[model samples]
Target chain A: MDATERPVADLPAQRDGQEVIHLDRVEKVFEVRRRAGLLRREKREVRAVDGLSFSVGRGEVVGFVGPNGAGKSTTIKMLTGILTPSAGTLRVAGVEPARDRARLARRIGVVFGQRTTLWWDLPLLDSYQLIHRMYRVPDARYRENLDRCVELLGLGDLLDVPVRQLSLGQRMRGDIAAALLHDPEVLYLDEPTIGLDVVSKANVRHFLADLNAERGTTVLLTTHDLTDIEQLCRRVMVIDHGRLMYDGEVAGLHRIAEVERTLVVDLATEMAPIALESARTVKVEGPRQWLAFPAGQPAAPIVAEIAAGWPLVDLSLREPDIEDVISLMYAGRSAG
Target chain B: MAHGPGRAALYAAVAAKGFRRYATYRAATLAGIFTNTVFGVILAQTYLALWAERPGLGGYDQAQALTFVWIGQSLHMAVAAMGGGSEEELMERIRSGDIAVDLYRPVDLQLWWLAQDAGRACFQLFARGALPLAFGALVFDLALPASPGTWIAFLTAVALGLLVSFGIRYLVALSAFWLLDGAGVGQLAWLVGMFFSGMMLPLNVFPGLLGEVARVLPWSSILQLPADVLLGVHTGTGLLGVYAFQLAWAAALLAAGRALQSLATRRVVVQGG
Candidate 1:
């Protein structure tokens, strides 16, 4: 059926044990208003997440990467049962989140780097304890989990400090600790490394990498940090303008960009001119020039010809990196 | 399955911790206290000026009239105003996906709110609303309840009346599921409650069917019942009956709020910001 034809009566998402998060043609639209003054009004709908359908396997670390406002947060909110989707079906932890949001809260832990979930004025430990009780973690299990978190996150020193008094880095640790107090099966992190210093960012990434490996906890992290994608997630999904544009292994992204190989050369003569066809000029600097082969073009013959014909001094070849690949992907869609 | 004292205790701990949260809070509570007093004084002076030398108006003497103003002013900040914030808080949380954390609580969300609210309600009564009321009475040299029994009954009536008021506010706040922001509706809800609860004046003075309507509505319980106790017009059987009605209203609102929350959660799309 067409998206608009999907009835609202379609039940909340249902899941079995293996699948932790699922979005079946899920779409979200926000009804907004533009005022022409005070009384006059215009209604508009913003499609933050278009018909998205995917599922997260247990213990899988999936990197959900997108440009800012490409509907990353909206997708996470729907998965975790925070906002109701305008269309499609969504399920998390054996239930539809939008349908039974409160019920799903126990199984999921969500953290947004821009906002701390811990109570602002309370000590970090107190806030965690409150969450511990809130999620009804058993006394012994709560203590065990907390002790591990504080130790793992190195939060012992900051536990007594109120959330507001803690530094941004300290607060992030506390927020992570608070979210984990219940030991949720899935952890949804939104821009967890945003704006952090290098050392802190590394510590967070290391902790996250370790957490995913040790617990086999399913992690769905949405971040703009390419390094995070490279470090932790094997599979990266890219979305832009509310649509899923790419879903594959990191290496597939690299291969797509690897189609073009760059050749850099230095001119032996000051007035030397290099001419080439079936190739593209990418960069020129000082006495060096770089040209790219269109995927199937032979680099060895082209280089031999350049060396024989032009006053080429030396040459080197390199493949495109992850940044180049993803940028190309984003750049492709933004054009049309 | 139900809200019990244990849940209230947890919520109270949350609230007590929240009470100390005052130090960081924008001096908002202190300002709120001042507003409470200002509102009380306005009602008192307005009535006193109109009454002139007359001892009573509409079957209420100076003490009764003054008590009504104090209770209404005190309640405006405590139970009623505290819950009014729920709508915006709920909307923001839902939009941000930060709400995921709140969902996991083993405690029922409604009960959780009840506990947290109990804390806020207590803080407002003691720090923001009631303390100012005490000072206002002293500053204005207002008549006091003469008997110890009257004070006891007044506290009971205040507590019961507050439960009713809290229930009504929570129900209004739950509208966030349908309306993006329920603050305007919540505020309007309280004002509507004020109309029937006699916050503006004695309900008896409203006349005809309106008075009968006010007598049965939850609004009258906000202040009128407590004021009646303070003036020594209510007690014993009458006090218990008022408490029963308050408890009933609280239960009804709870049922309705939970049903709404469940319905909302089921249909939630929880996607991008």
Candidate 2:
């Protein structure tokens, strides 16, 4: 039977511990009015999330990726009950999110990397205390969760500092802690590592992995960072144009997408493109050349060849990011 | 799981957090007090001139008119009578899609904001309000209510007025859901609030239809009714009537805000990811 043909009332019976999030042909259409000229206005419907269907199980960490305007955020908003779907049905933790948002809120925690949820003027701990009461977490349970988050997120010294005074990474950690004080069953993170330095990114990834391992918290993460997907998500879902493009193992994504690693070399002198068997120079500038090689292969040999044969001053390897992989998928789709 | 007492405590904590959030702006608070005082002096002098021109104008003697000026200044920030302070943050949050975080919270959005606004009102009542009124009293002779009962009644009126003000402002802030930019609505709200809340001129002083309409509008509850209660212009049943008026408007406006919020959440198009 087709997902669209399924009866709306025929929702799967409560399987709380198994499938924590379920969506069937979920669609979100936004009617936007644009001023055509001085007095005339034109209205158009943009189907932000068009007939999207997917689910996440308990203890599974899934990477949700899409290019800009790809409906990833729209789908998350529908799942979180922030935006009612124009069509289809969505359920999280056995509750219809839009119909029962406040109830569902107790079961899920969400963090937006671009913006903070913590009170900017208050101490980080004050915001946590407010969250404690707002969620009505039991005193003892709240303490336990708070202690765990504080310890793991390195929020000990940052608790007393005002959120406005903290760095972006510090504020993000504080936000993550606030979201977890209630021990939510599922976590939706949108670009949780957007602007963090290497150490902070590693710290967040480690903490999230531990969160899934210890508590079985269902994690649905959307990001532009592929390393986050490689390290944290065993299963990755790729959506574009408001539709799911691919959903499978991360390794499978790389196989199908066929990513390339770039070796950017700066030669001591401006020269013709380096002659190498393993890599091909994609672009060349004064004293600089970019070589593209199969990502599956190592970069050491290519670097050694350049260093030994040519006047190589410095070189750095650039991993293909999510955009590259997504464009590759798009190109392959068009060709095939 | 958190029943009656726990829920009430949670709201109180929210209010407390709101209080602390504003308290951090010590410099802003000081600057606000100075501005209120300066405006108070200018308005009082003008009122003095008008009262001198026509004695007992709008049922207020020269002293009573001066009292009105100072009281209006005091309640201005406390009630957010002109409608654009902390609610700007809510507008910005809505525009930037950060309101998604707010909706994710388990608490009722209306009540959470109401509690926080109440906290802001309480903080401003003292920090920006009391000092200006005190300065006004030092500079000029103003009408004084002799009884503690009168003071209590006035404070109760002020609290009710705060609710009405918050209801209007929250509605304006929630407009961002549809407008995607609330600055225009915010400016309109400020204009309506300033004109009808008796911040510009006392509702009593207006002539005929304008006075009658201004006196009954919800904005009147923010300043006019409260000021009247404090000035002993309303006594006995009149006092109860003023309270009832403020209560009705507050209920209606807040319920409207609540309805609009639910409607907005159903159709919300957050600006960005």
Candidate 3:
């Protein structure tokens, strides 16, 4: 077999902790047919993923972040072998996902937040049993995995309930358990916390954190919630318009986006907008003003400037939120 | 390192799961049995009226005609496995993008669905099939297959008929992979299947060349050939030929279904959930 189609066991040993997931210049173009006018139709090509390339080493948790329709879901689908790339090569655990999907399926788990993989009408335990058989998981291993997941994910009481009856959070946990029952080496979670309440979100986040830390399972997380990235991933990749916009440490994203920190100052009495060289007053109220300064610039200087110029009664510095950083990144790309 | 159950175990599990899934719909099963039994009585009365008018219509005596009506009703669920709509379950999965998850599984999609259908068929055979046939036997003087060999041959023919029916349904569902909205195509398939499969009327009832044409088509193997074997209309060598023809259609349709599925997978565009 070609290197791309090699069996997982035949993978060359890791010299420097080998890459478990690899993509080289992958592209996906969708042909959409639309009605042009009465009795006429037009064909359009949408480039869902454009020449994307990235790699993840074993046991690394990487956050894939982007705006809606930024090709995040498409990329994940390609990785999971649900969609074949129009061009380029992709290997997961040394197997071409599309060409050897069944083989690769044994080594990877996937959960789409908007969909449940469990049988809708079956009880949670029944769905797990079906998954056990579908994947051919051995009885001993199956029971072990089920017990572990149920214990760790708080699925004990929910096992008897049908998946349709479970709350979204409960169902999501069930899906996660189902995906992992086969002991896949890698996991792909797309918006795993979407629409979840605060408590459920925390439970999911905590479970994922423990899973990654304990098993060292490679994880690729795609989510809109910045807190999910902040808590789970140290490395993050930003994609926009089907291109990799940034790939670096999570904290480094703020500097790359060129977003600014905000300084909110409440003056003692009604006053003019605070004027300073280090920062600019972006908004002004009768007794309050908001200043914006480069995120990378020292916040101490901007705060000092604001205090000296205005009758500042209370002042606070707001770090650049991840949401602003990402938006700024997208805005910068569009403008340039 | 390989993990999980072997392929045989996985397939059996899928079939068993499919069976269990349908078994849970006790209410729907009861309703379906009721509808089929009611339809069987009406059709039997119509046949009796036809017999009164001609004594021996389309080569069927009164006893054989009554047997045909009841057996046809019992076999309705078994042969029309699509259950009125053409592969609606599979089509819904394809349209709703749930098929993507299915594609990711290690099992072959067509085979998996077929196994699931087998489970549903088993449930239907016991729940819907037995009752209608028993009800007909109670309410009407139904003729039984003359010998044990005939009973065995009839059962074999019915099994093959189920396989062929599943193949056709699977192929129709695969059309959703390309057409996206295959409801119209599905409707056309059911219409054609019902007319030619002798579900509407026995193929022998068709006049001259039209009857010959209906018998030659694959649809007759789905119901008429099996029913004919059961009624002792074809025996010994002729019965063997019927079995062979049913097997051939089952194999051909399943092969065509598999080929179509392969092509469809290449072009699968799973839409939004």
Candidate 4:
């Protein structure tokens, strides 16, 4: 059949509570040789991803978060069929990724933030044109998608520029647009905000949120930037030492980690650190004092205790940052 | 988008992109032209000096010998450049983990790269092949093919030569999948290719047994056969035999490349960051 003869359906209807991505105890072990002593070598098995099992429902925007070398990238690679799991079952959109990689490629979009998928020497438009042919995107659909991406990503003025010349932020936006030109049902973004400025990060986050909400594109995002998760992912999974440490809502992570929320109290006059039973003062600056209490604890009682004991001119409670929560979780895991 | 361009169109696009990529390196192309031209001059002079003493050596007169020199020079970039160091590019991509992205695409990795090399060879055939031959013809008394048939046969032999060369390079690059570093293998292949393929000197000049062995090897199909056909060294049935040898090697090596590529993909270990 001719390429143009294909139907123009947008997306397959999501089955009720059906998982788009499913992994059952998948494991990936890499055999690496390391220098032992003079001219000797040691063969070691590095279990990059060990016994991981998770399911992402249709249209769910999930964040896969971890510290460096925590198997996050490994998982993404497996999902894209770039790496095959050593053991266990893995499926994406009802297809085994490694076995049906070529077919899976048509249904998924991927972006790796550290390196570009664009042709460095070609203009952005040319890269898109090549991708159009590579993915076999229909002519009319290609134009429509390009127009939408160009306008929405603010890529109109930059389309003629070579990808090598674009700033990190602009190039990243261009990469995102390139991935989506084929209208994939699932988008896998690995560190999509790694090296962007604040404004660019916000822009990427906003675009991703809109993409997930409006298009119902299932997004699996791997990022070091916690703000990316806070803004985009309602469901976040934390992995460390090749194990899932936590998987739930973003707010629920603070409770799992036993993280502390900070309360900064400003006194009318400079005084010694206020003594409060409800909360411990972690830092004291002339007229201002910082207190730490369990994030799960009510801040009202602590505020009342401080007000009763000292001259509480102004006070505010700051929720725990995701970074702090994750580190605390890691620390607790190691200690235990 | 529901459907994309067909496989043939996608391969063509990759080839065109490769052509544009190499075309942008104007300085390198000029330098390559200069280097090939200089080598052609030196080779022509060497052949002239040798012919002055012997008058006719290895059944080639001075003019025919000079023509061989120029043809060898013109085809050098088309064959050697296309054959050389693509292994390094593949190894670099593997080390940088960019191979992951490449594997994720729907295209077959071997065919995609083959198309890219085809584009590069097409450009070099013009920029590096024709210009040097024109320069040699202008400066020296170069012999031309006697008939249209010889020209057509020579062109067909050259095309086969390119396919054989690409096959060899593809195998060398595929080594990176297992060896992790293809430099050593690539260097070794280059040495064997240069000597046996008659890029440096005609295989006919090699001592009796060595020349016979070179004729049977696939590398000879890459340069020597084409050069012989271009200079009208082989005629009639002998010429057909030469074409058959080239086609056989091209087919064999390309099959080997594809088989190796399949094995390599199964055990792809994308290294580093």
Query: Which candidate tops lDDT?
Result: 2
Name the TM-score of candidate 3. 0.85
Tell me the tens digit of each residue's lDDT in model 4 across B1-273: 133448888888888887777787799999989988999999899889988998767677888889988888888877764343345566677667788888888778877788877777778888888999999999999888768998898888888888899888888878878877777877788889888888777788776898899889999988888888878778899998988888888889989998997787777767643
Q: Model 2 segments beyond 4 Å from truth? A: A1-17, A35-40, A260-319, B1-3
Q: Against the native chain B, what TM-score does each candidate's chain B reach?
A: 0.86, 0.97, 0.93, 0.91
DockQ of each: 0.24, 0.65, 0.36, 0.37
- Candidate 4 clash pair list: A136-B3, A136-B4, A136-B5, A137-B4
Better of 2 and 4 by DockQ: 2
TM-score of chain B of 3: 0.93
Give interface RMSD, every candidate, in order.
Answer: 3.6, 1.9, 2.8, 3.0
Reference-based lDDT, each prediction: 0.72, 0.86, 0.82, 0.82
TM per candidate comes to 0.75, 0.90, 0.85, 0.85
Error of 4 at A291 (Å): 13
The alpha-carbon lDDT assigned to residue B149 of candidate 1 equals 79
Off by over 4 Å in 1: A1-53, A68-71, A83-103, A241-243, A258-327, A330-336, B1-9, B23-42, B81-107, B136-149, B176-183, B193-195, B266-272
How big is the positional error of residue B231 in model 1, measured in Å on the Cα after superposition? 1.7
Best by DockQ: 2
- Predictions: Cα RMSD each: 9.5, 5.2, 7.2, 7.2
Q: lDDT at A132 for candidate 4? A: 94
Error of 1 at A252 (Å): 2.3
